[model samples]
Target: MLEASLKTQMQSYMERISQPIEITANLDSGAKSQELRELLQEIAAMSDRITLVEGSDDAQRKPSFTIARTGTDISVTFAGIPMGHEFTSLVLALLQVGGHPIKLDEAVIEQIRNLDGDYNFETYFSLSCQNCPDVVQALNVMSIINPRIRHVAIDGALYQSEVDERQIMSVPTIYLNGEKFGQGRSSVEEILAQLDSGAGARKAEALNAKEPFDVLIVGGGPAGAAAAVYAARKGIRTGVVAERFGGQVLDTMAIENFISVKETEGPRFAAALEEHVKAYDVDIMNVQRATKLVTGGNLVEVQLESGATLKGKTVILATGARWREINVPGEQEYRNAGVAYCPHCDGPLFKGKRVAVIGGGNSGVEAAIDLAGVVAHVTLIEFGDELRADAVLQRKLRSLPNVDIIVSAQTTEIHGDGKKVNGLSYTDRKSGESRKVELEGVFIQIGLVPNTEWLKDTVSLTRYGEIEVDAKGQTSIPGVFAAGDVTTVPYKQIIIACGDGAKAALGAFDHLIRSSVDMPAEAETATA
Candidate 1:
């Protein structure tokens, strides 16, 4: 049930409804069902247009409900209590079903409505999952836009039998018509790209047709957002093309280190960054991955995986970084089938189960400490001779009864039954003895790897694949700069990334001005 303050907020939101909406509950007499019923009743009391109806108990899932416009098939369903990270999904569903307009691009809305095939999407999500809400909200909106599309957001924790039967070890695992669709966070455009085969081709063509930009950003993280805003404010044409707006930040959980902001979640911070950038004249193209960089032409050309080439006078690379994975056997095979990278996102799935955390640094130790509360046992394996975590963290980790730490141990292989992970093999550094931990999940908490693979031959990179940059964030290639985790900046923090991005933008602007001034008078006249 919602708190008093939350109820007041919901009332204010419900006042926007101009059409009647109905909440139909298909619940049993269980405790969870009763709790859901009380929550629904509280919701129905907020607005006159909203009404609750007791529906038949023939539904397959108990404690489930559907929100639909009166006398219309357009609706969205939740098989469990939509709280925690999904609280926004519940509120959005209510508002959208009550005739409140959705905040999406018009072209996207039309595309959703024009989809021809029948889509039955069922997404398995955990309440603690930060990425599940995006997929849930997107699918829910699509269902409302197109009556032919129906989506049900199921809480994986509540429906343990279903999760176990499907061998689901990851959050936000989506199923389309009873078959696996995707296994991670997805956006409306991404879902549409999968459902509609030609969507990618059409998007590539459109991107290829756009005019060149003064400053084109290759990422959409904090760094990219800051660069776009600064460049756009300078009265120049700016654009951002990203694989997924927010980059690694989207996968991040808690962000307490960001200055000024007391505390915030990754998704919320990323949303604010996007909103701030959108307030300017920056043109953001999401879900576009840059495959190649060409600095030969007058305008730098960034080739995308979709076969589209984006041209810009100066390019700012903020491609960011991703979680470093252990390339041992069965790691990739059982990924999401008990091999997870984010302990915060996937820890709940391994409740009362044994798991292993690879690494002895702060992230690994912290993850072990967190998992100790939810999982049955946690074994922290370190490749070094000792833990490199902070003293306080090590103290806290040592205090946990269900946690065990092993230093000087290298993870060799992850063992699975072809469907899910069952254990892992490791070797002791001192004794050179092989050992195995019988666990259900393996959480990799190593450092990050720069997303500079595409710039391998094009730019000067360190041995570690990070872009070599100067104080001004300029790369080896003239008029091309890099920032954030992709560059050789010391720390890879969000605030640091933002500062580096602003510096890179300024560096690009300075390069542009100097290059223009260095041109011959006749050349400048002709160019004008």
Candidate 2:
């Protein structure tokens, strides 16, 4: 008799709890409420997959529940509020609950699963940083690979509670097990090391070991050096990195105009800027490349090509575009000897010597004009019948005394005497004529190719492979930013690239500041 009574009471409770209640927006009334009621009725009748729950005192509050079956296990949860980055997290959570093993090497998994102690990681970041997406994705991937790794993305603007509690002043601030790790940018290897070493306690000493900088520019071109000067004058950390410490500017032969500096050589100008930046104690990393970006909850990660990773709150991507090659024979063998790309860098080296400028576009014509001023003679070769450059440029080229236009001509081979270029072979499309021109140098001004392939899966790109950025240089993915010739912006110039780099850096700073203030109070209040 007792069992029967208990069963009856359970049945009654289920009936009352399962009854669907009406849902109305706070502002909804009369017709709107009726429409919502109809919608709910239709939804309830469509499938038995969901169970409707009614709140105790709110007749207008109804939350739907879905019972999901994976293999032999079943789980239940509310179906609303799953979207955006949260949706990605939800899917991952579901997969984990469904017993789907994370796709990671056994060694990595074992190492992560063995972590039995509590860990707290914080990454600081701003939304305007173009390089942050790479770090964020890497962190998310690591988190998904290890269940014991509880990762949280705190907005520097929205999460004041956590920021205040952690005393975070930068975006991408990461803490492991309630202790502070290094800040700024980092890499996966660096992050793993920090977690394994119990919150980068050793790194704290190393951080103080280095001299304080006002601005540290990673590249030494116009962009990097300019940013360094600006930040240094403004009293910020300043530094720079480049292969030869001058970036692409060192390769140029001459600079006709660069604000106040008139008729200067590329290497000389770049050297001057390098000296200026170095005079202010700006750190420099010549011949270095940033290989990876890593982030924890609030800490940014940067990995170098040499396998070193650094931590910083803000980063500026001044990695300029590389010159595209013609891929003709003997081209690589005599790059600096006879074949060249930047006329402004190599033109003066061929003074009073025969030189050929390939292509018919603006760059090619401009290069031809510049070369005519120094070289004994300039041959402008174009594959098309007519020049593709502006009429003004064509007129200038035609009026030059030492310039010769060779239309319907294509370079077949670059002939060199093993050590340097002696001449080149070409084919005439009009008469099917093959000819060789003795020249001291060949300047290739076809165009430029941006280095954006690394960002393909992370952000949207245009047909030309440039990163698509909005007016403020924000990429499609939040926290990732891009600028300069790599973006869809018009004009690829030194001044423009420098301006873009500054904008990106400032944007990253803004995002970090905003996120620090916008985090949930509960998360902020939680003790380390």
Alpha-carbon RMSD, each predicted model: 2.9, 27.6
- For model 1, residues 252-330, the per-residue Cα lDDT tens digits are 8889988889999999999999999999889999999999999887899999999999999899999999999989999
TM-score for each model? 0.97, 0.49
Best by TM-score: 1
lDDT of 2 by residue, 147-251 (tens): 445444444333345554654433345566667666533545445655676434433344335442322344557766666665454444545544355555554
**How many collisions between residues are there in candidate 1?**
0
Model 2 RMSD to the real structure? 27.6
Deviation of model 2 at 311, angstroms: 2.9
